[model samples]
Target: MNLLRTLAAISSMTMVSRITGLLRDTLFARAFGASPYTDAFYIAFRLPNLLRRLFGEGAFSQAFVPILAEYKNQKGEEATRSLVDHVATTLVWATVVVSVLGIVAAPLILMGIASGLDGDGFDKGVVMTRLMFPYIACMSFVVLAGAVLNTWREFKIPAFTPVLWNLSSIFFSLFLVQYFEVPIYSMAVAVMVGGVAQVAIQIPALKRIGMLPRLSFNPLSGLKDPGVRRILKKMGPAVFAVSAAQISLLINTNYASNMGGGAVSVLQYADRLMEFPTGILGVALGTILLPSLSKANADGDIGEYSALLDWGLRLTFLLALPAAVGLAALSTPLIAALFNYGEFNAANVAAATAPLMSYAAGLLGIILVKILAPAFYARQDIRTPVRIAIGVLIATQAMNLVFVQMLGMGVAGLALSIGLGACLNALFLYTGLRRRSIYTPHAGWLGFFLKVVVAVVLMGLAAWFSQAQLDWAGLRSHPVLRIVALLAIIALSAIVYFAVLFALGFRPRDFMRRAK
Candidate 1:
């Protein structure tokens, strides 16, 4: 398979998901704005959302996919099918128990995560947490299904499934707000409905591959399977690695909650804008790389393994640098164009811009971590990342203390700390790879870096000038004009970036590679 084509396909699907997600966030901003109540909903949603990443996508996928690929590579189809059945059964049992515990302990969970909430805000958070807790089970199933599909090289379904969730939320936020006394509760309900939709679509896709997992009647049935045992053992470290990041986020949320009423919401809004590039590049590349890396490792082809890592890193720098430049240069206009409707006002746009700019600073590093982490995971070595993650977690908090407390940067400081931590995490992971001689940088990197830096500088200047021509705040009354102007600026900036790359002797064929 052509890796570039596969990455493009997955990225196209993910682009659709991100667009719909932006629409959903825009609706929320317009409907509820940034307030203590919206803060309650965002914070409450963060728990199940956190679990969705922690268990479903992050650790579980990291542990599960490489092993699944190994089984496919070494074992026969029947053995692979059996492994799937057992793993699915185990995941179902574990998620069910976790969901129950989360529902029952919702109040305590909210208290621990966002202790600054008080009275009705805290009460609403608890209730919303309980209502959305079971969404984890649904997403766990969805991710398990996705892992199977991805291992089979069926990337479209997994990449596109997120759009269902986004659409579900958009529909609810648009039409169902009036049904509830507290409209924000509708978002919680939407989360559950979206989860179900995501899981439902995975069924036919799994059936097409004839890898549909026949779950066992008894939850303990998969415990004796050696493959399941190995995956579980690997998961021990994977969970810790993922949790380290999540814990930092939780701490940030707690800090934001204590800062003021709309602090969490402001951060959430900035995060939503950041997700556009991250989902398209970071997630898309990571999803495509891991299984291929696993195959190369399984075949014991050191050259192929190193080549794959080099290709991913080069693509990351080529694309991510431009995206980060665009985000930083056009932060205010981007925020104003997408939001600044209904309940989202000039103040909200202004509040979100700094954090967005801060996030943009580390955008390339964040995407690099997505590329770099999978190198370790594909080798079935989760321990190194866990160790690095633990250190980064501690360092992130230290930076948080300095940026948020000592410097008094508020929410923007919280974002900056996370950004810097990601850069540090990526650096450590790269050094580990090099120290072990696992990945040797291919020739021409210096020239490539210089070209990209030059291109990004040109693109950033064009974007800055175009964005400055418009008063984004004043254009709030003309939403169409504002959105059109923003899109035009983005398009022009992208043109300039690619044109410069072309003039610098870069070509699409130069980066293309096939993975077997």
Candidate 2:
């Protein structure tokens, strides 16, 4: 498979979803603004989303895909299909049980997670959480189907499925806000709708591939399958590793909740913005590279596997480094331009900017980790990453306590702690890869990375100057003008970065050729 082509396709789809998500968030900020209600909604939303990442998307896919791929390779199609059916059935039942418990214990969970939210905020958060908890079950199934499709080399549907989620959220935030009476609660409804849509979108593709898994209560069928058992066993440790990072996020939210109304919302908005690029580049790379790496490892093609790993790392750094710099440089202007409307006030803008900058600083590390973790998982080495992730989580929490409580940095502190932990995690993963002889940096990687850094520095300076010029020209006074100015700056930075990279021996054609 052409890694670059796969990344391109995934990136294009993700860009659409990211833009739609931005529109949804914009509508959210306009309607709800940075208030206790908004904060409560964010807190309620975070729990399910965090779980989705940790369990449904992260650990489940990491552990399940390699084993699934191995089954497809070693056993016949019938055997692989049987394993899918059993695993899907079992996972759905498990998620349903867990979702029910979560709904019933919503209040207790909210209170534990955000003990500082007082009065109406706390009450509303619990209500909203209960309403949205079913999303965990819906998305868990969707993710399972997605993993199956991805392992089958049918990437487009799963990659495009997220558009449904973003569109549903945007529609609710826009059209349903007035009808629902309780506007914030409508967003929760949108989430459940989105989850259903996400699952629905994948069914036809599963049918087209003739791999639509039938739901059954017969757990014994796939339970005895070696691949299924192997995936399940590795899944335990993978969950622990991924949960470490997610737990840090929960801890950060707990601290943010105590900072009064809108803190959680502010942090969430900043995170969404940061996620735009990461999802487009980091996730696209990881998703595409995983099956490729798994296939190579399965065939004992270590050389090809190592080459893909190197390419994945370079692509991540090349794409994410400039994004981090550009975002950090233009955080406030971008936030103000996109969100300074309706109920979203200047204070909200101010609050969101600092944390966005902090997140931007760690953007490369975060994306690198995302790209590298699949390498370990592809080789079925889950426990090492899990152990490292646990260590990182502990360090992150310790830093969060010092920064949030002792240093009094609030959301920015939380962002800093996460960024710091990501840096540590990425370094550890790279070191482990080196020790295992799974990956070694190509001879040109250092020079290429240095060139990227130089290009990013140039881009950052250009963006900063462009922002200053726009400000001096009073462009920011008008929303349209501010948006236009922001776009112009972004365009200029991208051009400069690409041009400089090309001139510095970075070959676009070579990258594109590799994709072919």
Per-candidate TM vs. native? 0.99, 0.97
* Candidate 1 lDDT by residue in tens digits, 12-46: 99999999999999998999889999999989989
Give all candidates' CA lDDT scores. Answer: 0.91, 0.85
Where model 1 places Cα greater than 4 Å from the true spot, the runs are none
**What digit string (tens of lDDT, one per residue) describes model 2 on residues 370-442?**
8889999999998899989989998998998798889988899999899889989999999999999999777
- Global lDDT of model 1: 0.91
Name the candidate that leads on TM-score: 1
Model 2, residue pairs in steric clash:
none
Give me the runs in candidate 2 sitting further than 4 Å from their true place. Answer: 218-224, 471-477, 513-516
